[model samples]
Target: MHRSGSTTHSLFLSPQHPHSERTKRRPGLSAFLCFLAVLAVSLSPVPGAAADHRRPAPPPAVTAEGLRVLPAVAPVMSCGDVTGVDLRRAAGAEVTITSAVVVSENTPNPYCEVRGTIAPANTIVVQLPLEGWTQRYLQTGCGGLCGNASINYGQAAECPVVEDGTVASATTDMGHQGQNDGSWAAGNPQAQIDFAYRGVHVTALTAKALITKFYGRSPAYSYFTGCSDGGREALMEAQRFPDDFDGIAAGAPANNMAVQNTYHHAWNVLANKDADGNDILLAGKLPLIHDAVLTACDTLDGLADGVLDDPRACGFDPASLICAAGQDPAACLSAAEADVVRKLHDGAVDDKGRRLEPEISHEWGSELAWTLFVPVAQGDPVSSEQFALSYLRYLADPNNPRPDFELTDLEFTKEAFWETMQSSSYMSAMDPDLGAFKRSGGKLLLWHGWNDHHISPQSTLAYYDAVRGTMGKHAVNDFARLFMFPGVEHCSGGEGPDSFDVLTPVMAWVESGRAPASIIASKIETADDGAETVSRTRPVYPYPAVARYDGSGSTDDAANFASYTPKREIGPDYKWLGSRLYSSDYQTWCRAEGTELVCGQHRGGRNWLSREAGR
Candidate 1:
């Protein structure tokens, strides 16, 4: 969320700048860990940490509501337009944010600038920064951080809220424009630069860097925080640029890019245009079902605060809401509608039972695909999905005109989705090898909401299991952790209490050497249920299990969400010839063609680590 006064805007399209953000020298584990330690202390405000905004600022580029904002400087300004507003020590570095504003980078075609903000702008500049760089720093709302998705909605900014409360703050918007459905990236290449990889990476890096710049050194520890696409960004840095941060918080990341789009595309086919071309889950219907969903799962956590601590264990079936012979038609689901949701929630299965890919869920109320990656809700489809299925007869080649968003409809067919689109485009978002990251003592935090209506939480679980299949569980536990939130939607905000600060356990593990076992999720009943409590504390299972209590609490509590650790269930159904990425056995044989480069030489799940794995 941004400060109270900043306005927001939006445009679409894509970028420029061919020089990659890659580092020539791979950092050693010790040097990497040491930098993190310095970074940690740099950020925490000690009793006498000096007047954080102690130094003079560059200059006040914009004045709104009497706040001095240092707009983009020379180098960055020259790279593109003065699109973002960064409020820092007009000069020195304290990492505290005073205020911020996002403007249009004016890129063209498909992308856009959303809004952004971080509090006490002065101290913010000092706290976040990677490799001593802070280009256009600011916070983002909804789609703000999700590769410029904020253009699709509205973000209510506010005063800064910190964890330590000393000089702590949070950010929204990466300081650009994209309030509506336009492609700002079409005009400027630099805007594309900041949007695609620079924005959050640099914001975080600069924040950490300035923290050190202000305190005469870095923090005793440092960490990265984000979810969904942000989670994808975090993992991208680790795999491609491993030395960026020591501790990272990745929740319900959108890994497996190909699969993500495919999932959503399929849903568009189902939810939007029914067999008769009628919409199934309409605008108002979402909230209706949302309320029903809550009614069924909220109390499972024991607390009636209208929050479900864990949805994985809630076990509320859409079928339960099916309209019976005498039930109220308004509240109950018709068999056809219930079937639509069941398909929406379940992984794809074809007429032959073959599993398709994964997409996010249908965001019950929001227009953005917040609920499911692909909200094919048995209704009229989004403009983009409409083009995919009918493209053969409706248009030119996939890349000919390049539809609307980053990836278009025709481009999402199974073949293009999993193969070409993923590897060739930024949208792939697949999990890269993190062996080197683990060796460097890097800590990763992965979280998934049992009811994550977006990219199915199962995808995260499957990804985690894939990691374990190759990384060795104990090693992963030593540095990586996964937490599952029940009833939460997308990144945060839903029927469940969606507020948490995981940087707590992340910092502990990085500097203090304390790895977290679990974090408590609270479900407060703010309604008349007063004083009622719904709480659950579940193990932060490293990978496979996204988080499930032992089925004890109200079944809604994290405590009740049992752990879903699937032992290598090698049965006739699932032959464990080897890790999917490595083995060439009959089971993996079907799934390993184009993705084979990521597997090991041994070619079987057992020897995934063989020389061939990293190929």
Candidate 2:
């Protein structure tokens, strides 16, 4: 996947050089931790500390009444024309401006689309509305491994919001030009750094500087939005640069980055393979497993609308699908197939009950997609295998730099898992502290589909809990909110209502001090050829509050539903794996004992580090 779409334009008017904005070499663990400590203090507007001078004034309104007073443009520009503008920056001569043209709006509003590259590798685009400037800036996120900047749907809803309000929006490829290819980061250190955190951050800063030059004033407010890896970027902005965004909306954040792509993904792929190396859990059997899961749990939330509103509470046993003596393998799952589903629902865990990663909800909404990585037909490695192999071959193993590394060379034991974590410290963003973000008056809206298979909703839940545990519940609620979408898969689309406007509520909260209690989600009923018709709407309440039926009337209408606070389940405690990247308040005996067989200690309990685990 090489850089595609429109070709780049010449450097127009770049005021600052890339050299001026150049980042230092990636920090070591000790240096990064120390930098975080200083950053927290610097971002916090606590008493006695210097006041934040960068905090901008309230943005001007772009209301119809206000638009009446604005001046109209004399000449409308074309979509691929940039006649007069300078954009040369010091990063290097390699950076090129691909295009700068006016995009005709559906609402008939016009905006300039400025596209460019950043030196060695980085595709960036900024869209500046020609009128109705709201003094707000938005940077959307890229999905998967962020190989392409054009794959950003993070701002799907945001584009309209920004256009309507005349807000400027920008997006970047996150340092590569392909999509879902781990090979892009194979030997590229700068690309890896950009993927890890730099790309989005640089884009945000560069976009803002360009916006200021275009509009003669900086944006009053800034935001970052993304899901999946984009979600990771959103968190990275909030965590690494607390002042970057006034509001951030992250969905299904792959914050446990390296772990998910490596160990967790490997665990899922390995689960599908049998003793003879045959994949019994083929795509054909998905319906069987899905029906079994739905039968046991679809009605758990007071409605049986082909979606599980609360899969976590539904105790569906996969062993029930195990065939009796007379049943055929095609009709009923063999013991091995049932075991695979069980492991997926149970999540990745060591010999002990300790969860390596959160359980991927293997319900009706997400089961079909599970077959994507199962090499049932050709015995070839799937995307997960490709990703894992690349990570192990290039990034994870310091000595083994061979690109030809096979999936079989990788081990799945606890020791092997710990070893992988050791080399991936710079990649993962599992840090739980959000005090800096909160104190900086940054508002965070986190959401994840309950039926997400790519990244577990439980992982997001765990992260939210960590923030709450580290910062008190009330304190977290003051600045951050979590909305769990039941039955939605990955970022969107599933058995449940997946379409919703999280951005509107988050922006309202950020600007007006009003918090969002619930966001309405809708599922459209499509015709035979997939043309959308009427939609079934429902309100997605914040975490702990689920949409329960009102007992009568149309179940499809959101009016018949109400938010109900369910009894809270005691979720996973924040247990730290002995990754040099992961921070720990307690010690793991496996790090001390060097084996899981004899490891024993107070699980999830906080304590001082032992000499061995401390290493």
Candidate 3:
């Protein structure tokens, strides 16, 4: 996907509504029909049917489910049909589709476009160019595993895997199905292990193969981009298959899967009460809180701008919104209810002294409760939530499942930091070793939002610091760049500014080798219906130091945020959580410094985010 020229714009909208549409089942092909069709019987053999076929004379009956794959030249097995699509004008480049290629014999999953050309010399190709077109991979919003649950455009749970013949793209179902990634590899630990290991290995092989088939040669450069769980995936690739992509863009990755789920369960528990013991506020309150928050914090950027330029600097308090006596029974949170927000925003701890992690934002709970998260107070019976709890359960145990999201202060203890979560524990600190990726002469563009309620932007800084800490700071700085957005939530919706394609500079850094010192992040404008409306831009600092806006020129200009130097020197200050990444015992020494300052280990370590958006 190429960016439009300056003053031009493009918007990609996914049309499929999250799972609300009822699916009609089609009667599958008949088993008897296969016996009469000679070609179908020969090529569509079921798995493990080799011995039977090798017999002096194969059995007369053949089944699609019993087919074994052999090399294309092995026999005259029936070749699938293919279709060609005209994409030259579609991509605005000399793009071509040889034909739709169906990789499977039992199921006719046809996909067209053997290659895509962003420019005359650029082509993202694929192997197995077909003779016809059909759907290559099913799409879903469920991250990791595609759960039966559905979401919408405002809240994209996940993006289904599309084998649309790019240079290389992948979806694992995370080893299970029903998710945007189709991580069809859940429940089975072996699948998880493979997903963590061989999954990347196999995918790299497939991508290389596709690059060869489409461009007549393998790709000299490749990249990966994803947010939340996708962030986890990006890191997974770097750790397990670092050589595949030259650069990667991961946003708020859900690394420590196990504990994150536990934390979500716990947060949902905390969010349960209304002033009256009987009346409970539902998940719908999240957006309400989010809107209120943006209203209060958006102007902090000094432009009356509807974006939050610095969440850390904003002093708005949740207590300010508490319901006054008799202010419409259930409309607003009571003082007690507000306390929930405070402790939740602060983080959770159980009666046993164990602490449950908090959502990236206090407002994340209210929004996700109804907007995207699993609700316990609802008939569903899960407790505790903070956004990512559902994905964790869906990927780890799609067949059975966790007890929804049960919450207990006892479960939320000091020991519960992040290291203990069986599923999402490592998520908060999944910085991979990029020594090889950097040594290969590659460059990376990493960014996140500071106010991100989902995966905290702090996680991004932690990962970057790990790279800088391990490799020389200047060395990592040579090929890697980091951007932090101040108030963006999850990805897009926040009070601070939120418009601008962060990818352009990344592409520039990779292809042109013009290392980026910083990037300009923007938010929407009041009259943003026009194309060039993404006119606002803010300079983002590299690290340690921050971009402070100078009250001059248009606040919309990136030059307004004067660049400052990083304060944290390239030295040793970070610490691993323990044998586990989120271990309570392993101290950042920062957290030990206590939450007196804007940052420290106890405050949960390195704080970072994409330009104007929060990580």
Name the regions of candidate 3 deviating beyond 4 angstroms: 1-175, 179-187, 194-197, 274-303, 320-333, 352-355, 358-410, 413-432, 470-472, 524-532, 565-615
Better of 1 and 3 by lDDT: 3
Candidate structures ordered by lDDT, highest first:
2, 3, 1
Q: What's the CA RMSD for each of the models?
A: 14.5, 11.7, 18.9
Encode model 3's per-residue lDDT on 1-615: one tens digit a residue: 111111111121000112122111112212221221211111222222236555654443321222111111111112222223333333223333333333433222332223222222222323332332111111111244322222111111111111122122333332223333323333343333333333333334443443334334444445556566556666665653455566566566665554444554445454554444232445555555656666776665455654554454455577777878868735677676566656555444556533343223343223332333334355444423433345444433333445353333324444444324332322333544577667665556566766565555545665676667667788887877776666566666665444434433443355444455555455544445433334455666656556666877787666557776545443223333222253222222210012111112333433212111121
Q: Put down candidate 2 lDDT per residue, 37-90, tens digits, no spaces.
A: 121111211122234688655443332111112332222344454424444442
Better of 2 and 3 by lDDT: 2
Q: Top model by TM-score, which number?
A: 2
By summed lDDT, the worst window of 10 consecutive residues in model 3 runs over 6-15
Q: Give the lowest summed-lDDT range of ten residues in model 2.
A: 14-23
Residue 590 shift from truth in candidate 2, angstroms = 28
Model 2 misplaced regions, further than 4 Å:
1-98, 105-107, 155-160, 163-165, 350-354, 359-365, 375-381, 398-400, 528-531, 570-615
lDDT of 2 at 566: 63
